[model samples]
Target: MWLEVLLASVLGFVIYWFISRDKEETLPLEDGWWGPGVKSTAKEDESIRPFTVETSDEEINDLHQRIDKFRMTPSLEDSRFHYGFNSNYLKKVVSYWRSKFDWRKQVETLNKYPHFKTKIEGLDIHFIHVKPPQPPAGRSPKPLLMVHGWPGSFYEFYKIIPLLTDPKGHGLSDEHVFEVICPSIPGYGFSEASYKKGFNSVAAARIFYKLMLRLGFQKFYIQGGDWGSLICTNMAQLVPSHVKGLHLNMAFNSRNLSFLTPLLGQRFMGFLGYTEKDVELLYPFKEKIFYNIMRESGYMHIQATKPDTVGCALNDSPVGLAAYILEKFSTWTNSEFRNLEDGGLERKFSLDDLLTNIMIYWTTASIVSSQRFYKENFSHGLGTLKHERLKVFVPTGLAAFPCEILHSPEKWVRSKYCKLISYSYMARGGHFAAFEEPTLLAQDIRKFVALAERQ
Candidate 1:
């Protein structure tokens, strides 16, 4: 009888383990006030107002005067972007920016799409909303909120937005038309910077979630690459039922299994569910993972600790700001570009496009506040945040770009995102997927949305 009782207890324990393991978890939906002073008891304004990208002669002339005043430093002989943005290439870039680049034309380009701003938590949030020119006969356009990361703005989505919203016009299927909403994270571009402290990713996520609901999207899709990846992940965790699907080109995994790679080595990574591609991208762990992180993360250390100190210089000088920001555009695009004299920036992007993005930061004077976002997110330290500990329970799609700063394997991503339904090994791209490879990213999004809709 005792033997039978022991058998029953073991069976009950096994069932309980499986049930608990499969149970869905969510991050708490928390409230926050990022505006100056204490929160008010009165109802917040819910009006969405129109906004336009305007550039005046004063702004352009000031930028040119700064460019003319820039003191150029000679780079070390044969030192490419490895050391940083090469001074020689920068001189050339500055010449074009000062003489040829047209800020007025770019502003016109920015205003091509419908732009709007709405006050949320006592701050004005800026975003561009684009709807399909022609929706499919029986289907309404799916609402998608695309968030931008640091060193980038809502402009990154310009090329990809058209493809997603007007697929048929772009020679793609209209089966999955989308109404894309690209929002500048508060304190980034035209969006109002937070006046209060403690405005981290969770707070940003909550604000963007509120932005979507105000836009009348009860259920919508969320996609992001850098900070956007973390914010969207937080959104899915904070409100899974509202987020129909989550898609990311870059994913952050706190439960990373990279430590085991050295112990198991390349051949046995399969044990950890790493594909051959994952092994190729991650292995020689010393160079690819360790040294690369050390090399690329110098800016992060400063941004997370003393952003204001460096941001002052960057904010004041357009030339200094270009070098500071464009360096990432080079190395992060493909680390190999660091070996090239020009940092291979114009290979995947045009100087006009690149300069326009820089202009957004320059004109807005948002560099300091944008850098503070790093401190706000990292001030408390990593893995301690409530959202970081919880697993996202929404359907997720990951596009593992080959040249991304770090490659996160499907197994590691699945550990954090419980409902990872689609994982694709992208053909070629890096950190800035939408800006660099819009067609490929759009194709992947289409495929992911189809799979997600079926579910």
Candidate 2:
């Protein structure tokens, strides 16, 4: 009787172990070479080198010439930003860029943070690494990797870096000071563009993971907003052991929940774990969710199918590039800004800051390469990628900014991030959380880090 009882217990334990092991599955880490030609037989360079943002008089002069030659088109009367960037407003912006906006000053601002580059998978990856000025005694600063998205660069994190790296100086607690690393996605900013095809988020994630390892960090925290969000999530999926925590201002979740949740309606939201705030942001599903997606996603279609087609015009015409990119900044920051004449661009951001971002793309001549990212990501199809299906088991946090393109309920976020530890309904902000509301984002990161550290 004793032997039979022991045998039965052993059988049950074996079954349970297999089930638990199955639940802990991770994505495979594949290798690739994204250089222009064939992979080299020589050992890859492993040295990290210092880099700087440099601009010439010729570059500035060329930009001014393009602005001068930009053919003006009359905007429909009272159309505001309805059609696109208001040509009238464009004139004002051009006047400022040509007269008041100074690229040389902005270049100095870009160089404020220490910059570095290293060859990864045949591409030159550019990143800004900022260490805490004065960390708490007897404590090492936490390493945090932040990534930027389309129409933005590493410059987006400039405002938030000081706050994270030196919280006490910024009137915040120094319990969790950070050593921030902001990288330019390959093909964006100073980073060398991938000459080969199929360089998607997974590839970016792998390269960044290699970057952290090269920088001497065995484990670290990661944060992101747009494309940054997806890449960071993939990093967690690829090497869950190396990622200590993952925090995102934007959540790229499954469409399975996206389609099912809305149909349930507000009455059933509470029953399904959605909060009152979630319902408020997600309700009027047509205007806020459906129509809003359609209205805002026109650029996606263009970029995904034929980025190079439009890239030609944007690359040659600096004014056109500014309009194309700034339109996203205006409407995405707050959709209602579209109803205003100046697109309410100056409400949360200054002309100097906005133009600086545009100039990164303009000077780098990366508009076409950046647009190709859309094609590489979506050229296959959404939700079909392996990473999209896998659940992230790392400690995860989500900050639902009020004015983001879409409001992802905590429930939906948890579907992908199985170990979600923090979900905050941000007080006020939009798509560009770090750039627009640095203090709020920094506070949230600190809050999320505290929770994650406890875990």
Name the 10 consecutive residues with the lowest summed lDDT in model 2: 13-22
Query: Can you tell me which runs of candidate 1 are displaced by over 4 Å?
Result: 1-23
Instruction: In candidate 1, list every pair of residues with a backbone clash.
Output: none
Q: In model 2, what is the error at residue 56, expressed in angstroms?
A: 1.0
What global local distance difference test value does model 1 have?
0.89
Candidate 2 Cα RMSD (Å): 7.4
Task: Estimate, for each residue in 263-308, the C-alpha lDDT of model 1 and write its tens digit.
Answer: 4466556644678888899978988888999999999999999999
List model 2 lDDT by residue over 1-455, tens digit each: 56544544464455345334435567899898998899899999989999989999999999888898889999999999989899999999999999999899999999999999999999999999999988789999999999999989999999999999988998888999999999999999999999999999999999999999999999999999999999999999999999999999999875333445565456666755778898899889888998899989999999999999999999999999999999999999999999999999999999999999999999999999999999999987987887766778999999999999999888778767889999999999899999999999998999999999999
Regions more than 4 Å wrong, model 2: 1-22
TM-score of each: 0.94, 0.94
- Whole-model lDDT for model 2 versus the true structure? 0.91
User: What is the TM-score (0 to 1) of candidate 2?
Assistant: 0.94
RMSD of each predicted structure? 5.6, 7.4
